[model samples]
Target: MQTCALAEELAADNDFILYAASLHPFARADDQELSEKERYEMIMQELQIIGRRFISQGLHVHVGMPDGETAIKVCNLIQAFLPIFLSLSCSSPFYEGKDTGLLSYRTKLFEVLPLAGLFEYMENWNHFVDQIEDLRKYGIIGGIRDLWWDTRPNPQFGTVEIRVCDLPVKFTSILALVALIQSTAAWLVEDVEGSSALSPYLLKANKWQAARHGLEGRFVDPTAILGDHPMQFRLAAMILKSRVSPYASKLGCDSYLEHLDSIISGGTGADHMCRIYQNTGDFHQVVRAIQKEFWQ
Candidate 1:
């Protein structure tokens, strides 16, 4: 909270205020600001037509693992739940001052990059390392960071980075997501034997559903026999609460986990922004409402 407050204060000092949505709803074509780094410059050049649109924010949660093998295992196991995280953190419904007709348009934008979106399933640590090495050897990427997968094994940090979530508007919602991700990772480490690797196609479809409809999307669980029928994503998330509760409690993040219920009942940040726009019929008013709600 102090970090956020300090950032707000610094921005205010410069006669500017922070807007916490994943995409800048009012950005223009000429708003493609480039960084000093060569890597970012190269990315901007490659993006060309979609350079400005590529500017979006996301929340990346890194959970430490014992080794690269464990990180890969958790990344594989957690693929099935990435969409749930995206659904909870959908805050990019508007883009370039227009309603985008998608809950998290940011997700779609990021996937436009060459090596972005869901990664191919890895068999183990060696499989992951070999792929990275090949990508570098072929000059396809400069480093592992170039593979912008939704979830990846960060060998440098000994962590599994979950990068699918939008930057949720409220700080508490951010904490809730962190608690959920950490607890889920802990649970995966303990019960990984019971979890199976989901098909990449199924994972991609589920992720697309989440990006389109947020909580209202349908999720197909291949693991369940009779329950293989599609169900609302919200219900699927609620069902997961029980499985992760013991881990959350053990992690002493039960209070934060409880906040997930508030998010589910109240709606995601995207839902809130959409409602505001619907009521006011003005994008400016939508942004003002978001700023007000964010500081509360």
Candidate 2:
């Protein structure tokens, strides 16, 4: 069976269970497929372990927009929501038998690169495309490499891809996330004018808070930058439950509340990590526990 098909049809049905898998050599479409690199081969064993644990790890979301411009608009509008998803979906809080304290530390590790984030708004597709062209022309950056944003445009598929969450151990999490992405795109296509514009700083601030607090964070209203008050997962949950539940339900994710309610009550992946730490007081033990619970 195709790996992707297995992920959707089989792995997710039983408690959102996703079999872990290793990550082997990563190749680009423009590059050679087979290589004799020594170091890459040396690490293949560990990579295979990762492969078995994650099964096939990726955040594959399909946006509803027809063009890159709309993708950009929707991406910018929903950038603020990315951290909320991250907080909720993070599962790899323990790594290599360690209590990292950081929820989804695996996901955050990608941010070490300059391009790993949702950046400042592009005025439009013209500007967006033009910037890439200029970067390529000047040799400053390659043409549209996977800049790991919380969300990014998949130009080839004409869909915006959001890479905020960690590898969901359960397939249902992936389905719920995809459903949320689809409904969000649908909402944007129909209600672009209804969204209030937020400055870049406030957006980043909210993301920082969500990363720290997970579902417990006090999210700033994107429209109310100067407002002293803060929003909570309670509000985010309400929006997601109302806007995303129906669509998520259709994708064999009828258990959408199972995922949402997990965060609502248990907090988020980060919250779970904290609980684990409090119990064992060891990072390595946490990672070991996670590896057992998630992979076995």
Candidate 3:
């Protein structure tokens, strides 16, 4: 929040218009009122295509791994939880001054970019490198950074970087989600056997549900492995209460983890924006609420 305030002050000093958005909620259907072309021109020529459509912000969490081998293992283990993260971080329900009726519209929007969904499972570091090399070999991508999977191995940093979450509107939400991600990733690194082996198909379905309904959506049952999906709130409560509490204690972030329960009960940031729009019937009012929460 202090950083945001500082940025706003700097923009004011420079006399440059700075519009903060996960994407421009007022101009989703029309680009005439936005600075899309201006943004595109500022990016690399090769990346211009993506930069043109990339008006959103996201929160990325990197968990340290010992090596590429461990990174790949951790990435696979954490993939199942991406949708849960998305649900809690959902904050893009409105687009183009209208309710899009989807939480985390940014999720679907970002996925439309090439190589932006779940990473293909790889057995080891060698397999992971081979797959990336093939993409580069075919001119499908220029480098590892171009393979914008929801989670990827950051070989340079020796960490597993998670990229599925939208930029949370509140600092509290950001802290809580980051703590959750770190705790879960650390736990998985220590006890890989407890992680779910959900298929890519199930993972995609859950991601779609999370984007569609936020926490109100149901996640595919990884526990049952085969049954009717359960409400995300129920699964989340079960996981946080049973599995993650110990990790929160270990990480010394128990209070932040507990705040997640309040978030789930109250609503996501996007959920809050939607309620504001519903009561006021004004899109500008929604934007004001977002700004307030973001700096709160």
TM-score of candidate 1 versus the correct structure, residues matched by position = 0.95
Query: Is candidate 1 or 2 superior in TM-score?
Result: 1
Question: lDDT tens string, model 2, 1-296?
Answer: 26766664574576543333111112122332324676445434434533223312345455646887787788777776676666566654554444545555555445554566665577788887887788778875554553546777778777787767665544455555566666655655665553444667767776666655566667775644224467685567556567655555554454644456644665554455557778978754544454445421
Instruction: Please report, in order, the local distance difference test score of every candidate based on alpha carbons.
Output: 0.85, 0.57, 0.74
- Weakest 10 consecutive residues, lDDT, candidate 2? 20-29
What's the lDDT of the predicted structure labeled candidate 1? 0.85
TM-score result, candidate 3: 0.86
* Alpha carbon lDDT at 241, candidate 2: 61
What's the distance in Å from true for residue 264, model 2?
2.0
lDDT of 1 by residue, 1-296 (tens): 89989998999999878888898777765766677998778877887877756778899999999987788888888888889889999999988888899999999999988888886778888999999999999999988788889999887888899999999998888899899999999988997553456787888898999999999998876455215778888887787776898999999998988889877888899999999888889888877788778855
Give stretches of model 2 more than 4 Å off: 1-60, 95-98, 194-197, 224-228, 246-258, 273-296
- At residue 239, give the lDDT of candidate 2: 64
Off by over 4 Å in 1: 194-197, 225-227
lDDT for each residue of candidate 3 in 129-245, tens digit (9 for 90 to 100): 888889889988777777779999988788889999887777777888888888887777776553435677878888898889888787875544224556664366446445766
Q: Residue 34 of model 3: what lDDT?
A: 40
Q: Model 2: what TM-score?
A: 0.70
Residue pair clashes in candidate 1? none
